[model samples]
Target: MKAAIIGAGPAGLAAAEVLSEAGVAVTVLDRMPSPARKLLMAGRGGLNLTHTEPLDLFLSRYGAARARLEPAVRAFPPEAIRTWCGGLGQETFAGSSGRVFPRAMKAAPLLRAWLARLGERKVTLLSRHAWAGWDAAGGLLFNRPDPEPLVLRPDATLLALGGASWPRLGSDGGWAPLLAARGVALAPFAPANSGILIPWSAHLRDRFAGTPLKRIALSFGGRTVRGEAVITAAGLEGGAVYALSAAIRDAVAAEGEAVVTLDLRPDMTADEVARRVAAPRRGQSLSNHLRRHLALPPAVIGLLREGEAPPETAIKGLKLRVTGVAGLERAISSAGGIRLEELDEHYAFRRLPGVFAAGEMLDWEAPTGGHLLTACFATGRAAARGMLRAMVG
Candidate 1:
């Protein structure tokens, strides 16, 4: 059997490996000049391969999509990914935070090893071939830079085109319209793991645009995420903000904006903060008092003074109005794609037989810290296995 895996990101690559191993002649195609552009970019800050947390707790990171992704993830869990990396000559180790990374601390080495293995398996990788849906004869149409588009008739096709984020690195969400035209159920694309946009005053934006608020807790919609957030020219972003992005995005969608409560010092109680603030000032200025007693940084003090300084009890509850979410181009990842209802348990499109999908193209969203990459790899393997089953049956 022959299989064509479109979009050479983690999902497509993983699918290619699985199908090729199953004795299928596989070809991986990508629109970019090469492949795995996003993967390479993700490693700029030390590639986070996966998380070492317990299966149940780790699975919870995917939020609403946990149920849909459970099967694939369970089949190829974090341990499997680590083992796979080891097989590629890239041993992985978990960090203090439980995030896993290859020993090389880069993506290029792993990708190079993977691509070499693919070459050994005789899996064809065709770059600069952009899929343009199908033609009249049910042949896959791809538009190259040249005049005539290329058409291919493969036994099975897997569309792993990613979500609408990091367009320059590929995954521009251009596949959504094509899939929608084919009567495939699709959910509207929205930014996931994106920063929030707040109408910050000019002073705050100018002074603290790149400032980091370390050890902070952000609360929204009765949920709280504790991590560091950075002040951007437009708003705030970081691990914590990305964790709560779904709730904040939904709240902003339902309403005009969402109010996020920022806890500058989550380690201390409000009463403790009050007591500290109320301590003997010794004729110190209010700012100095805050700095000395509360140990609040300049950025925090400036942020507090941006509007009205709340009482000590309410200090931990400083609210910021989130006007919008960062655009897809700026988002780390995107949410909403081909609705899962359109597919069977195997991830094959029921409306289009012989076609399967995996990765961010599917309607699912997960935060950073390796969840996204793990799901991509898992789903890719699952889709390939589904194709193998179908071919055998």
Candidate 2:
């Protein structure tokens, strides 16, 4: 059977691999000039293929969609990802943070190897083909630049168009309107792993923009995440900020703003901080005392000055008033998409049979590190299995 996989991101590529292995003729189509642009970008920062955390904790990271995505993830868990990477001759290693990466620490090698494997399987990759939804006759139509549009009818189709983030890279969320018109239920897209826009003063913004706050703990809505965050000109961005993004994003949506508490010295206890602050000034200025005793940098001290003077314990709970989340353009991933209920157990659309979806295009969001990539691979494989079952059975 002939299968068409759209978007060519992690999800679509994973699905293509599965379908091709099942003796199906797979053609992976993408709008861009090449495939897996985002994946290449992700590899720049060391491609986090998956996490080495325990299964239960790893599954819990998907939040409410855990139950919906669990089956696929379980069927092809983190171990499977490492095995698959090994199959591609990419040795996998877990960092101290439990994030798995290829020994090469780059995406190019893995991607090149993967493409070679796909090529060996005769899985066709047709780039620069922009999907323009279905034609009047229910045939798939694509917008080719040469003015002559192309149309085809495959036995099955998988739309893994990704989410609204990194639109310039290909996943522009342009497919949402098309799918919605087909009576598919959709959740409005929102920034998932994105920064929060805090209205910092001109001085801080000018001086501290791009400053990295290391060994910090951020808390919001009773959840605490410890990691590093960078002070962007727009606001806060990085792993810690991303971990709190969902909570802060929801609060901002519901209440117009959200307050997050940042612990500059997360390794120290509240009492320890209080003791350090209570030490004699010894003719030192407040800034000097903070720097000397607490070892806080000038940027962190600037943040402290933004708030009212409080007890030493309060220093550990410095509040940041977040205005809104960064837009999808700046987001690493996106939350919300085709709602889970709209799809069946096989990741096939209930309203549109013979069609399947996977990856960030679905209504699930997870923190960065490796969860996102893991789920993408899992769902993509699952969607292909679904398609194969439908075709065979």
Candidate 3:
């Protein structure tokens, strides 16, 4: 069987590997001059491969689409990913937060090794060929540099063009209009794993514009996460905010604004915080008191002052209103895409047969720190299996 996989990111790569292993001839295609530009960017901060938590808890990260996603995840899990990496000669280690990373801890090395193995397995890699819509027979059409176009007739084709977030890296929702033109229903892509915009006082913005808020607690819609966040002149960014991004995005869409409260110190209770603040302050200023008493970081202190300078007791529990969320251009990943209703359990387009979709291109969103990559890999493998089954049947 011959297969063509589009978008050479994690999903497409995984699909290629699975099909090749199953003795199916595979050709992977990418529009970019290089494959997996987003993957390489994800690795800039150590390339989180997967999480190390228990299966149930880790799976919970997928949220509303857990039922749809669990099957694929069970098929190719974190352990499977780790094993795959090990085979690529990249050993993985779990960080303090239980997130997994390769020993090399970089995307380039792993991608290079992976491409080498794919070459060894005889999977063809086609780069610098942008995929146009399918032909009348649903055959893949490509636009090469300064050429008319090339038509590829594969036994099966998988579209993993990714969601719209970083258009520069090539997963621009550019595929949406193409698929929609073919009657494929697609949800409007919105930003996920992105920051929110909170108007900060000019005074505070000047001091803490680019500061990091370490070890704080952020709460939204009954969900709480303990992580570090960075304060930008425009708003909040970092792991903590991204954790609550989905909820924040939904809430913002529903209402004009959303209010998210930060414990700023979840490790301490109201009483504890009150006690800490009540500590005798003889000569030190309020800023000094907060800095020395609560051991608040300079950024947090500056942020608190920016919003409102409350009485010592009032500082125990603070409230902040979030006006809006960051835009798609600044988001790490996008949320909405082709809904699961468009595809069957096999990740194959129910209406468009002999074609499959995988990865961020599918309708599901998760935070950073491996959830994104994990789901992409799992769905790609599942889609490949679907293609293999179709070929045999």
Instruction: Flag clash pairs in model 1.
Output: none
User: Could you tell me the TM-score of candidate 3?
Assistant: 0.96
Writing each residue's lDDT as its tens digit, candidate 2 over 15-89 gives 999999999999998999999999999999999999999999999999999999999999999999999999999
**Reference-based lDDT, each prediction:** 0.92, 0.92, 0.88
TM-score per model over all chains: 0.97, 0.97, 0.96
Clashing residue pairs in all predictions, respectively, total: 0, 0, 0
Query: What does candidate 1 score in Cα RMSD to the true structure?
Result: 1.4
Runs in model 3 with CA error above 4 Å? 308-311
Task: For model 3, state the Cα shift of residue 159 in Å.
Answer: 0.3
The sequence of per-residue lDDT tens digits that candidate 1 reaches over residues 91-204 is: 999998899999898999999999999999999999999999999999999998889999989888999989999999999999988888999989889999999999999998
Worst lDDT 10-window in candidate 2:
305-314
